[model samples]
Target: MARPAVTLDNYDDVYRYYLDHRQNLLSARIAYAALSARFRPRVHYADGARERLQALLASGTRLIVVANHLTDRDQYTLAATAWQTPLRSVIGRTRVLAKDELFTDPRLRRAIDLMGSIPVFRSQNHGLRAVADAGRRMMDVSAQRLQRGDVLAIFPEGTCNDGDPRRIQRLNTGVGHIAVKARKLGAPPALLALGIAYGPDPSVRGSADVYVGDPVLELPTTPMDITRAVAEQLQAAVDDVRAVR
Candidate 1:
Protein backbone atom coordinates (compact mmCIF):
# COMPACT_ATOMS: atom_id res chain seq x y z
CA MET A 1 0.00 0.00 0.00
CA ALA A 2 1.17 3.48 -0.86
CA ARG A 3 1.68 5.72 2.13
CA PRO A 4 0.03 9.13 2.32
CA ALA A 5 2.00 12.33 1.78
CA VAL A 6 3.08 14.48 4.74
CA THR A 7 0.00 16.38 5.90
CA LEU A 8 1.75 19.09 7.88
CA ASP A 9 1.49 22.23 5.69
CA ASN A 10 3.53 24.79 7.62
CA TYR A 11 7.23 24.18 7.80
CA ASP A 12 7.44 25.57 11.32
CA ASP A 13 4.77 23.21 12.59
CA VAL A 14 6.34 20.38 10.65
CA TYR A 15 9.70 21.05 12.26
CA ARG A 16 8.16 21.23 15.69
CA TYR A 17 6.37 17.95 15.14
CA TYR A 18 9.61 16.34 14.17
CA LEU A 19 11.38 17.81 17.21
CA ASP A 20 8.85 16.50 19.66
CA HIS A 21 10.40 13.78 21.89
CA ARG A 22 7.44 11.51 21.81
CA GLN A 23 8.49 7.88 22.18
CA ASN A 24 5.87 5.28 21.56
CA LEU A 25 7.45 2.41 23.47
CA LEU A 26 4.90 -0.10 22.29
CA SER A 27 5.68 0.65 18.68
CA ALA A 28 9.40 0.85 19.37
CA ARG A 29 9.45 -2.56 21.03
CA ILE A 30 7.60 -4.06 18.09
CA ALA A 31 9.98 -2.52 15.55
CA TYR A 32 13.01 -3.54 17.59
CA ALA A 33 11.72 -7.06 17.74
CA ALA A 34 11.27 -7.14 13.99
CA LEU A 35 14.77 -5.80 13.33
CA SER A 36 16.25 -8.22 15.83
CA ALA A 37 14.49 -11.13 14.21
CA ARG A 38 15.94 -10.11 10.87
CA PHE A 39 19.50 -9.16 11.77
CA ARG A 40 20.48 -10.68 15.13
CA PRO A 41 23.70 -8.66 15.06
CA ARG A 42 26.71 -9.24 17.32
CA VAL A 43 27.51 -6.27 19.57
CA HIS A 44 30.97 -5.19 20.83
CA TYR A 45 32.45 -2.33 22.80
CA ALA A 46 35.78 -0.88 23.84
CA ASP A 47 37.31 -2.26 27.02
CA GLY A 48 35.20 -1.34 30.08
CA ALA A 49 33.09 1.04 27.99
CA ARG A 50 30.08 -1.24 28.08
CA GLU A 51 29.95 -1.32 31.85
CA ARG A 52 30.50 2.44 32.00
CA LEU A 53 27.74 3.05 29.49
CA GLN A 54 25.39 0.84 31.42
CA ALA A 55 26.20 2.76 34.57
CA LEU A 56 25.48 6.04 32.87
CA LEU A 57 22.16 4.81 31.52
CA ALA A 58 21.30 3.55 34.98
CA SER A 59 22.06 7.01 36.32
CA GLY A 60 19.67 8.71 33.86
CA THR A 61 22.37 10.61 32.02
CA ARG A 62 21.62 11.80 28.50
CA LEU A 63 24.13 10.87 25.79
CA ILE A 64 25.02 11.96 22.28
CA VAL A 65 25.62 8.82 20.17
CA VAL A 66 27.74 9.46 17.07
CA ALA A 67 28.39 6.83 14.46
CA ASN A 68 29.61 6.30 10.90
CA HIS A 69 26.98 6.05 8.20
CA LEU A 70 27.45 2.98 6.04
CA THR A 71 24.00 2.02 4.82
CA ASP A 72 20.32 2.95 5.13
CA ARG A 73 19.69 -0.01 7.38
CA ASP A 74 22.06 1.36 10.04
CA GLN A 75 19.17 2.93 11.89
CA TYR A 76 17.29 -0.33 12.23
CA THR A 77 20.48 -2.13 13.19
CA LEU A 78 21.21 0.43 15.87
CA ALA A 79 17.71 0.16 17.22
CA ALA A 80 18.04 -3.57 17.39
CA THR A 81 21.44 -3.27 19.04
CA ALA A 82 20.01 -0.95 21.66
CA TRP A 83 17.17 -3.38 22.24
CA GLN A 84 19.44 -6.37 22.65
CA THR A 85 22.21 -4.73 24.68
CA PRO A 86 22.40 -2.72 27.88
CA LEU A 87 21.34 0.27 25.79
CA ARG A 88 17.85 -1.20 25.91
CA SER A 89 17.10 0.94 28.95
CA VAL A 90 17.73 3.98 26.79
CA ILE A 91 15.44 2.95 23.94
CA GLY A 92 12.64 5.30 24.92
CA ARG A 93 14.96 8.01 26.12
CA THR A 94 16.80 8.53 22.85
CA ARG A 95 15.99 10.65 19.81
CA VAL A 96 17.54 9.81 16.45
CA LEU A 97 18.59 12.54 14.02
CA ALA A 98 17.17 11.68 10.60
CA LYS A 99 16.95 13.36 7.20
CA ASP A 100 13.80 15.37 6.46
CA GLU A 101 12.92 13.51 3.28
CA LEU A 102 12.24 10.46 5.39
CA PHE A 103 9.24 12.16 6.91
CA THR A 104 7.56 12.51 3.53
CA ASP A 105 6.28 8.96 3.73
CA PRO A 106 3.53 8.79 6.31
CA ARG A 107 4.02 5.13 7.16
CA LEU A 108 7.78 5.37 7.62
CA ARG A 109 7.40 8.70 9.40
CA ARG A 110 5.00 7.14 11.88
CA ALA A 111 7.45 4.38 12.71
CA ILE A 112 10.40 6.75 12.93
CA ASP A 113 8.39 9.19 15.04
CA LEU A 114 7.53 6.35 17.37
CA MET A 115 11.23 5.65 17.72
CA GLY A 116 11.82 9.30 18.75
CA SER A 117 13.49 10.79 15.64
CA ILE A 118 13.97 14.44 14.68
CA PRO A 119 13.97 15.54 11.03
CA VAL A 120 17.05 17.20 9.56
CA PHE A 121 17.29 19.11 6.25
CA ARG A 122 20.82 18.95 4.94
CA SER A 123 22.13 22.07 3.20
CA GLN A 124 23.21 20.03 0.18
CA ASN A 125 19.66 18.88 -0.52
CA HIS A 126 17.89 22.23 -1.12
CA GLY A 127 20.86 24.44 -2.00
CA LEU A 128 23.51 25.24 0.58
CA ARG A 129 22.18 28.62 1.75
CA ALA A 130 18.51 28.05 0.96
CA VAL A 131 17.98 25.47 3.68
CA ALA A 132 19.79 27.42 6.38
CA ASP A 133 16.58 27.97 8.29
CA ALA A 134 15.77 24.25 8.26
CA GLY A 135 19.27 23.38 9.35
CA ARG A 136 19.00 25.85 12.23
CA ARG A 137 15.69 24.43 13.31
CA MET A 138 17.17 20.97 13.37
CA MET A 139 20.06 22.12 15.52
CA ASP A 140 17.84 24.21 17.80
CA VAL A 141 15.38 21.40 18.28
CA SER A 142 18.16 18.88 18.81
CA ALA A 143 19.79 21.12 21.41
CA GLN A 144 16.48 21.63 23.17
CA ARG A 145 15.90 17.90 23.28
CA LEU A 146 19.36 17.37 24.68
CA GLN A 147 18.67 19.97 27.34
CA ARG A 148 15.53 18.04 28.17
CA GLY A 149 17.61 14.92 28.91
CA ASP A 150 16.92 13.07 25.67
CA VAL A 151 19.80 11.04 24.28
CA LEU A 152 20.40 12.09 20.68
CA ALA A 153 21.96 9.79 18.07
CA ILE A 154 23.56 11.42 15.05
CA PHE A 155 25.52 10.34 11.99
CA PRO A 156 28.17 13.04 11.75
CA GLU A 157 29.20 11.98 8.25
CA GLY A 158 25.75 13.19 7.04
CA THR A 159 25.56 10.56 4.29
CA CYS A 160 26.36 6.91 3.79
CA ASN A 161 29.69 5.72 2.36
CA ASP A 162 29.44 3.55 -0.74
CA GLY A 163 33.10 3.15 -1.64
CA ASP A 164 35.44 2.08 1.19
CA PRO A 165 33.63 0.98 4.33
CA ARG A 166 36.76 1.64 6.39
CA ARG A 167 37.38 5.22 5.32
CA ILE A 168 35.12 7.86 6.93
CA GLN A 169 33.86 10.76 4.89
CA ARG A 170 33.98 14.37 6.01
CA LEU A 171 31.81 15.02 9.03
CA ASN A 172 29.14 17.71 9.41
CA THR A 173 29.56 20.19 12.27
CA GLY A 174 25.88 20.09 13.13
CA VAL A 175 26.50 17.45 15.79
CA GLY A 176 29.22 19.55 17.39
CA HIS A 177 27.07 22.68 17.31
CA ILE A 178 24.21 20.85 18.96
CA ALA A 179 26.47 19.58 21.75
CA VAL A 180 27.95 22.99 22.45
CA LYS A 181 24.59 24.71 22.34
CA ALA A 182 23.13 22.13 24.63
CA ARG A 183 25.90 22.82 27.16
CA LYS A 184 25.31 26.55 26.98
CA LEU A 185 21.62 25.90 27.53
CA GLY A 186 22.53 24.17 30.84
CA ALA A 187 22.34 20.57 29.55
CA PRO A 188 25.76 19.22 28.73
CA PRO A 189 25.27 15.65 27.65
CA ALA A 190 28.03 13.06 27.46
CA LEU A 191 29.24 12.01 24.01
CA LEU A 192 29.47 8.37 22.97
CA ALA A 193 30.74 7.09 19.63
CA LEU A 194 29.05 4.03 18.17
CA GLY A 195 30.49 2.02 15.25
CA ILE A 196 28.32 -0.26 13.13
CA ALA A 197 29.56 -2.79 10.57
CA TYR A 198 27.64 -5.09 8.29
CA GLY A 199 28.75 -8.23 6.53
CA PRO A 200 29.51 -8.34 2.80
CA ASP A 201 25.88 -9.09 1.97
CA PRO A 202 24.60 -5.98 3.81
CA SER A 203 21.12 -7.40 4.09
CA VAL A 204 18.65 -7.70 6.93
CA ARG A 205 19.82 -11.22 7.63
CA GLY A 206 23.50 -10.37 7.26
CA SER A 207 26.00 -10.54 10.12
CA ALA A 208 26.56 -7.23 11.91
CA ASP A 209 28.79 -5.75 14.60
CA VAL A 210 28.47 -2.66 16.82
CA TYR A 211 31.36 -1.04 18.68
CA VAL A 212 30.84 1.51 21.45
CA GLY A 213 33.64 3.82 22.41
CA ASP A 214 34.37 5.47 25.73
CA PRO A 215 32.49 8.66 26.60
CA VAL A 216 34.31 11.77 25.41
CA LEU A 217 34.59 14.09 28.40
CA GLU A 218 36.89 16.73 26.99
CA LEU A 219 34.97 18.58 24.30
CA PRO A 220 36.55 21.62 22.62
CA THR A 221 35.16 25.09 23.11
CA THR A 222 34.49 25.80 19.45
CA PRO A 223 32.00 23.79 17.42
CA MET A 224 34.41 23.11 14.59
CA ASP A 225 37.10 21.91 16.99
CA ILE A 226 34.72 19.56 18.72
CA THR A 227 33.51 18.27 15.38
CA ARG A 228 37.04 17.35 14.41
CA ALA A 229 37.63 15.58 17.71
CA VAL A 230 34.37 13.71 17.37
CA ALA A 231 35.15 12.74 13.80
CA GLU A 232 38.44 11.20 14.87
CA GLN A 233 36.83 9.34 17.75
CA LEU A 234 34.03 8.01 15.56
CA GLN A 235 36.48 6.96 12.88
CA ALA A 236 38.50 5.02 15.44
CA ALA A 237 35.39 3.24 16.63
CA VAL A 238 34.40 2.37 13.07
CA ASP A 239 37.88 1.05 12.42
CA ASP A 240 37.61 -1.11 15.51
CA VAL A 241 34.34 -2.72 14.43
CA ARG A 242 35.30 -3.10 10.79
CA ALA A 243 38.27 -5.24 11.85
CA VAL A 244 36.07 -7.62 13.83
CA ARG A 245 35.47 -9.88 10.88
Candidate 2:
Protein backbone atom coordinates (compact mmCIF):
# COMPACT_ATOMS: atom_id res chain seq x y z
CA MET A 1 0.00 0.00 0.00
CA ALA A 2 1.20 3.49 -0.84
CA ARG A 3 1.82 5.62 2.21
CA PRO A 4 -0.45 8.66 2.41
CA ALA A 5 1.18 11.78 1.03
CA VAL A 6 1.91 14.35 3.72
CA THR A 7 -0.23 17.48 3.39
CA LEU A 8 -0.97 20.47 5.60
CA ASP A 9 -4.56 19.27 5.89
CA ASN A 10 -3.38 15.99 7.41
CA TYR A 11 -0.91 17.21 10.01
CA ASP A 12 -1.88 14.58 12.56
CA ASP A 13 -1.52 11.77 10.06
CA VAL A 14 1.89 13.09 9.04
CA TYR A 15 3.19 12.87 12.60
CA ARG A 16 1.78 9.37 12.96
CA TYR A 17 3.55 8.23 9.80
CA TYR A 18 6.97 9.38 11.05
CA LEU A 19 6.37 7.88 14.47
CA ASP A 20 7.23 4.41 13.15
CA HIS A 21 9.06 5.16 9.90
CA ARG A 22 12.81 4.65 9.62
CA GLN A 23 14.82 6.05 6.76
CA ASN A 24 15.99 3.60 4.08
CA LEU A 25 19.53 2.47 4.92
CA LEU A 26 20.95 2.99 1.43
CA SER A 27 19.52 6.49 1.22
CA ALA A 28 20.82 7.37 4.68
CA ARG A 29 24.30 6.15 3.76
CA ILE A 30 24.40 8.13 0.52
CA ALA A 31 23.10 11.28 2.20
CA TYR A 32 25.64 11.11 5.04
CA ALA A 33 28.46 10.38 2.62
CA ALA A 34 27.65 13.53 0.70
CA LEU A 35 27.43 15.59 3.88
CA SER A 36 30.68 14.17 5.21
CA ALA A 37 32.50 14.93 1.98
CA ARG A 38 31.25 18.50 1.93
CA PHE A 39 31.49 19.50 5.60
CA ARG A 40 34.27 17.37 7.09
CA PRO A 41 33.63 18.63 10.63
CA ARG A 42 36.12 17.87 13.40
CA VAL A 43 34.49 15.78 16.11
CA HIS A 44 35.53 15.58 19.80
CA TYR A 45 34.17 13.43 22.58
CA ALA A 46 34.36 14.14 26.32
CA ASP A 47 36.42 11.74 28.41
CA GLY A 48 34.74 8.35 28.25
CA ALA A 49 31.75 9.86 26.40
CA ARG A 50 32.37 7.80 23.27
CA GLU A 51 32.70 4.57 25.20
CA ARG A 52 29.55 5.38 27.21
CA LEU A 53 27.62 6.14 24.02
CA GLN A 54 28.72 2.83 22.53
CA ALA A 55 27.66 0.99 25.67
CA LEU A 56 24.26 2.70 25.80
CA LEU A 57 23.50 1.89 22.17
CA ALA A 58 24.79 -1.64 22.62
CA SER A 59 22.26 -2.06 25.42
CA GLY A 60 19.43 -0.98 23.11
CA THR A 61 18.74 2.21 25.06
CA ARG A 62 16.98 5.00 23.15
CA LEU A 63 18.55 8.50 23.29
CA ILE A 64 17.14 12.01 23.27
CA VAL A 65 20.01 13.82 21.58
CA VAL A 66 20.00 17.60 22.04
CA ALA A 67 22.32 20.17 20.50
CA ASN A 68 22.93 23.89 20.51
CA HIS A 69 21.92 25.48 17.19
CA LEU A 70 24.39 27.88 15.62
CA THR A 71 24.20 28.52 11.85
CA ASP A 72 21.75 27.25 9.24
CA ARG A 73 24.48 24.81 8.24
CA ASP A 74 24.89 23.45 11.78
CA GLN A 75 22.68 20.49 10.93
CA TYR A 76 24.87 19.54 7.97
CA THR A 77 28.01 19.87 10.05
CA LEU A 78 26.50 17.87 12.90
CA ALA A 79 25.38 15.16 10.51
CA ALA A 80 28.83 14.96 8.99
CA THR A 81 30.52 14.78 12.37
CA ALA A 82 28.02 12.23 13.64
CA TRP A 83 28.94 9.99 10.72
CA GLN A 84 32.43 9.86 12.19
CA THR A 85 31.19 8.67 15.55
CA PRO A 86 29.46 5.58 16.92
CA LEU A 87 26.24 7.29 15.84
CA ARG A 88 26.95 5.89 12.36
CA SER A 89 25.60 2.61 13.72
CA VAL A 90 22.07 4.07 13.88
CA ILE A 91 21.96 6.39 10.89
CA GLY A 92 18.64 5.21 9.52
CA ARG A 93 17.21 4.69 12.99
CA THR A 94 17.47 8.32 14.19
CA ARG A 95 14.72 10.91 13.92
CA VAL A 96 15.71 14.57 13.61
CA LEU A 97 13.22 17.26 14.53
CA ALA A 98 13.33 20.03 11.94
CA LYS A 99 11.35 23.16 11.24
CA ASP A 100 8.41 22.52 8.91
CA GLU A 101 9.56 25.02 6.28
CA LEU A 102 12.31 22.60 5.25
CA PHE A 103 9.65 20.25 3.91
CA THR A 104 8.08 22.66 1.42
CA ASP A 105 10.43 22.04 -1.46
CA PRO A 106 9.73 18.69 -3.11
CA ARG A 107 13.34 18.02 -4.08
CA LEU A 108 14.78 18.93 -0.70
CA ARG A 109 11.91 17.17 1.06
CA ARG A 110 13.00 13.85 -0.43
CA ALA A 111 16.52 14.33 0.92
CA ILE A 112 15.17 15.43 4.28
CA ASP A 113 12.97 12.35 4.37
CA LEU A 114 15.99 10.21 3.59
CA MET A 115 17.65 11.80 6.65
CA GLY A 116 14.71 10.70 8.81
CA SER A 117 13.52 14.22 9.71
CA ILE A 118 10.28 14.98 11.46
CA PRO A 119 8.57 18.30 10.71
CA VAL A 120 8.11 20.66 13.64
CA PHE A 121 5.66 23.55 13.32
CA ARG A 122 7.06 26.29 15.50
CA SER A 123 4.93 28.86 17.26
CA GLN A 124 7.01 31.73 15.86
CA ASN A 125 6.20 30.71 12.28
CA HIS A 126 2.54 29.74 12.76
CA GLY A 127 1.68 31.80 15.87
CA LEU A 128 1.23 30.26 19.31
CA ARG A 129 -2.54 29.86 19.15
CA ALA A 130 -2.36 28.37 15.67
CA VAL A 131 0.35 25.81 16.29
CA ALA A 132 -0.76 24.80 19.80
CA ASP A 133 -2.63 21.68 18.80
CA ALA A 134 -0.12 20.70 16.13
CA GLY A 135 2.70 21.17 18.66
CA ARG A 136 1.00 18.80 21.08
CA ARG A 137 0.58 16.21 18.36
CA MET A 138 4.23 16.55 17.38
CA MET A 139 5.37 16.04 20.97
CA ASP A 140 3.11 13.05 21.41
CA VAL A 141 4.43 11.46 18.24
CA SER A 142 8.02 12.16 19.32
CA ALA A 143 7.42 10.54 22.70
CA GLN A 144 5.83 7.51 21.06
CA ARG A 145 8.79 7.15 18.71
CA LEU A 146 11.19 7.30 21.67
CA GLN A 147 9.24 4.58 23.38
CA ARG A 148 9.65 2.49 20.24
CA GLY A 149 13.47 2.70 20.47
CA ASP A 150 14.11 5.39 17.85
CA VAL A 151 16.84 7.95 18.57
CA LEU A 152 15.42 11.48 18.80
CA ALA A 153 17.72 14.36 17.81
CA ILE A 154 16.59 17.87 18.64
CA PHE A 155 17.93 21.44 18.78
CA PRO A 156 16.26 22.57 21.95
CA GLU A 157 17.12 26.20 21.29
CA GLY A 158 14.43 25.96 18.57
CA THR A 159 16.23 28.33 16.16
CA CYS A 160 19.69 29.31 15.05
CA ASN A 161 21.75 31.44 17.42
CA ASP A 162 22.40 34.83 15.82
CA GLY A 163 24.55 36.13 18.66
CA ASP A 164 27.66 34.49 20.11
CA PRO A 165 27.79 30.92 18.80
CA ARG A 166 29.67 29.91 21.93
CA ARG A 167 26.83 30.71 24.28
CA ILE A 168 23.79 28.44 24.01
CA GLN A 169 20.46 30.19 23.82
CA ARG A 170 17.58 29.47 26.16
CA LEU A 171 16.07 26.11 25.31
CA ASN A 172 12.38 25.54 24.84
CA THR A 173 10.58 23.21 27.25
CA GLY A 174 9.27 20.98 24.49
CA VAL A 175 12.28 18.62 24.73
CA GLY A 176 11.70 18.14 28.44
CA HIS A 177 8.04 17.46 27.79
CA ILE A 178 8.87 14.81 25.24
CA ALA A 179 11.35 13.17 27.61
CA VAL A 180 8.91 13.11 30.49
CA LYS A 181 6.16 11.74 28.31
CA ALA A 182 8.42 9.07 26.86
CA ARG A 183 9.39 7.98 30.38
CA LYS A 184 5.77 7.72 31.35
CA LEU A 185 5.22 5.54 28.28
CA GLY A 186 7.90 3.14 29.66
CA ALA A 187 10.87 4.13 27.44
CA PRO A 188 12.90 6.38 29.80
CA PRO A 189 15.32 7.56 27.14
CA ALA A 190 18.89 8.51 28.01
CA LEU A 191 19.99 12.08 27.21
CA LEU A 192 22.92 12.89 24.95
CA ALA A 193 24.13 16.45 24.35
CA LEU A 194 26.02 17.36 21.18
CA GLY A 195 27.73 20.74 20.97
CA ILE A 196 28.74 22.35 17.67
CA ALA A 197 30.95 25.40 17.00
CA TYR A 198 31.96 26.81 13.64
CA GLY A 199 34.98 28.90 12.74
CA PRO A 200 34.96 32.73 12.77
CA ASP A 201 33.37 32.83 9.34
CA PRO A 202 30.65 30.20 9.37
CA SER A 203 29.01 28.82 6.25
CA VAL A 204 27.39 25.73 4.78
CA ARG A 205 30.69 24.13 3.81
CA GLY A 206 32.89 25.48 6.62
CA SER A 207 34.64 23.05 8.96
CA ALA A 208 33.30 22.91 12.53
CA ASP A 209 34.16 21.48 15.94
CA VAL A 210 31.64 19.15 17.58
CA TYR A 211 31.66 17.81 21.12
CA VAL A 212 29.72 14.82 22.41
CA GLY A 213 29.00 14.94 26.14
CA ASP A 214 28.57 12.03 28.48
CA PRO A 215 25.02 10.65 28.40
CA VAL A 216 22.65 11.12 31.33
CA LEU A 217 20.88 7.90 32.21
CA GLU A 218 18.48 9.37 34.75
CA LEU A 219 16.20 12.36 34.15
CA PRO A 220 14.71 14.94 36.47
CA THR A 221 11.15 14.34 37.58
CA THR A 222 9.47 17.47 36.18
CA PRO A 223 9.62 19.10 32.78
CA MET A 224 11.04 22.41 34.04
CA ASP A 225 13.66 20.62 36.12
CA ILE A 226 14.58 18.41 33.20
CA THR A 227 14.96 21.44 30.92
CA ARG A 228 17.20 23.14 33.47
CA ALA A 229 19.44 20.08 33.79
CA VAL A 230 19.66 19.67 30.03
CA ALA A 231 20.56 23.33 29.64
CA GLU A 232 23.44 23.03 32.08
CA GLN A 233 24.78 19.88 30.38
CA LEU A 234 24.41 21.31 26.87
CA GLN A 235 26.23 24.48 27.91
CA ALA A 236 29.04 22.36 29.29
CA ALA A 237 29.23 20.48 25.99
CA VAL A 238 29.36 23.75 24.09
CA ASP A 239 32.13 24.96 26.37
CA ASP A 240 34.07 21.77 25.77
CA VAL A 241 33.95 22.25 22.01
CA ARG A 242 35.02 25.85 22.27
CA ALA A 243 37.91 25.07 24.63
CA VAL A 244 39.25 22.40 22.30
CA ARG A 245 38.78 24.50 19.19
* The candidate that achieves the highest lDDT relative to the unseen native structure: 2
The per-model lDDT (C-alpha) reads 0.80, 0.87
Clashing pairs in 1: none
Residue 182 alpha-carbon offset, candidate 2, angstroms: 0.7
Quick one: how many clashes does candidate 2 have?
0
> Stretches of candidate 2 above 4 Å error?
1-9, 204-206
Q: Residue 209 in candidate 1 has what lDDT?
A: 90
Per-residue C-alpha lDDT of model 1 across residues 85-139, encoded as one tens digit per residue: 7777767778898887888877888888788887776766767786777677778
Candidate 1 accuracy as TM-score: 0.92
In candidate 1, stretches whose alpha carbon ends up further than 4 angstroms from where it belongs are: 1-9
Model 1 lDDT at residue 150? 81
Worst 10 residues of 2 by lDDT: 1-10
Question: How many clashes in each candidate?
Answer: 0, 0
